[model samples]
Target: MRKILIITGNYGEGHKQAANALYKVIQLRQLNYEPIIIDFMEVTHPLLNPISHYIFINGIKMFPSIYGFFYRKTRAANSMSEILNKINNLGVSRLLKTIKEVEPSVIVSTFPLAAGAVSRLKEHGYIDVPTVTVITDHTYHSSWIHDNTDRYIISSEYVKEDLQSLGVPKEKIAVTGIPIRPEFCHNLSVDPLRTKHGINPSIPVVLIMGGGVGIIGDGSTTIRALENLPKKVQIIVVCGYNDKLKKQLSRELSNSKHEVILLGHVDYIHELMAISDMLITKPGGLTTSEAVASELPMLLFKPLPGQEQDNAKLLTDLGVAFQAKNTKEMIEVLSFSLFTPEILNKMRGNAKKIHRKWAAFEALDVIDEVQNATSSHGTPMEMNS
Candidate 1:
């Protein structure tokens, strides 16, 4: 069997979710491949692991504005290549040693850091495996489009254009959309899901989420806005791992006439999406993709800086969603649209039109091509940009 290594990290759920989707597609196809998914921080350097985790979490917490500023600046800077090169030199030796032991025939990286590490290894002749990067966000960051990568599976054509503007070869970019779990691909009947959730079919259902961390800016205010909406709408708020927020919401919404359900870290978001009339969320790549898969339109709440902001713009531009920067605007938008069945149906249609459900299969096909070429040569595949 051929060995394919998938590298991801826990910086956010998008990378891990994308990697899992590709893994499922490969398994379902029975492609004669052994896929191993590794979180690079777990295997490469133990001492640096915690530091990296802290930097991701605390950086967002303490200096989100500064982080966002630098993130956007890096995307437009000509010196980004030099900066990546320096970071690559510092980390590539440890990563190369680890890859040498695994001896993967092909590599798929979901995180830019891992992609950069593998690119450096290939550049230095430490590994010859063909490396494909699946960009986990709608926005194209310079870190994601490395010189040594063979192909990039991006979320949209906008991202492809962004890469081309940065001088990446057009052939090297594929707009496969973001890969999502196979369960999300199934066509679920909304009536049954609504029945299961005990939501009234007559009432519009709103599914609210704040990615994996469950903390959005002004979440309390958002909840307050929901309370003031038409009482006929039922609300399901997923506070992932944010127990305090869940409790606060539970307490505040205790006697509300609307059927408000508060959840903490659910494994069945697809079911929720199926039953929802619209999703109120931050436009994380995975969350938006999942919403599209379920044919649910989005009303973007407070989007975080950097990639999410770009994601929001892409969705809004596509006419599949609207953005609300404050509680008053969110309520105004929801109030006017929640009861408009025709408008809601059109948004759902737009979502289905934009969703690429076969993205996982397309990604798997690329992997198979790489494996076949490598096996024919009796050597690890050499990547060409």
Candidate 2:
């Protein structure tokens, strides 16, 4: 059986989640193709990935400004990014060995570092496999563009132009929405979900996602703010893996006015999303894509300084979401926009224009087209590969 190797990393769940979502699509689309997901850093240096994951999660929390500085510094074509990429290439030898062992018919990268490594392998004639990069974020970054990459599956049209400005051929880029879980892509009924979840139809539902690691913030300020709202509302807090946060919210909200549902990490996020009227999140690419797919309006809580900020800006610009500068502003935005059904409906409609329900399947289509072209031409695939 032919195999498709998907490379990802554990810096955050977004890369790994994107890889898993595509793996699901590959499974459904190709009966003969076996999809495998590997943590690239584990393959390169087994001991390093855990340390790296710890540093990444804590870095944002401990020293956000410094982390933000590097994010901006490496966002465009710059010497700093060049130096980092050069440093990263030290692992390419191990990466090439791993690739050879897998012997995948097609390879897709959900992490930029892995993409760079694979590009080096192809450049050195170590492998001739077709390589595609699925960019998990909506923003443009210089590191993802490479001379040898066959195709780019991006989420935004402007990102496609950004790639073109960096000299990538237009045909090499396709503006397919970021891949999400197959469950979110399925058609869902909000009223039925609300009833099943025991959500009151008359009360507006607000969902606060603490992200995969449940680090949105201490629930004190947000909880207090939401409790003070005069309107009757229901708040659903998904604290992901932060057991402490979940317990704190449950204790603090026990006597709260609003109907509160506190959930720990769950596989049924799609179900929670279907029942809610609005999402309060950090605007991670995967979360935002899921929100759009569910037709849920977004209220982006205080976004971090890098890609989260960019993702929030894109959503606000498209009118699907609004960004709040702080807790005060977030409450105010909710008071004004959340109460108005007209504005909420309009935002949902805007989200519809940008949301591609078949993004994973679209990615599969691109891979198939690339393989067919390679078979017919017997050469390195051209644009649109």
Local distance difference test values of all predictions, in order: 0.82, 0.83
Candidate achieving the largest TM-score? 2
Tens-digit lDDT track of model 2 for 1-385: 8678899987767888889888888877756788889988888767777888788898887887888899899888689998988887766677776666777778899998888888877886777888899999988787787788999999989788888888889989988888888888887877888888889988899989967888774556676678657687999888888888888877878898899988888888899988888999888888899899888999988788888888889889999999887788888888998789999899889988778878888887887666556642122322210
lDDT of 2 at 99: 67
Sliding window of 10 residues with minimal summed lDDT for model 2: 376-385
Q: Write the per-residue lDDT of candidate 1 for residues 200-304, one digit (tens) a residue.
A: 888888889987777666566678667778656799999997888898888888888788899999889999988888899888898898888788888998777
Winning model by lDDT: 2
Worst 10 residues of 1 by lDDT: 376-385
What is the number of residue pairs that collide in model 2?
Answer: 0
Residue 366: error of model 1 in Å? 1.4
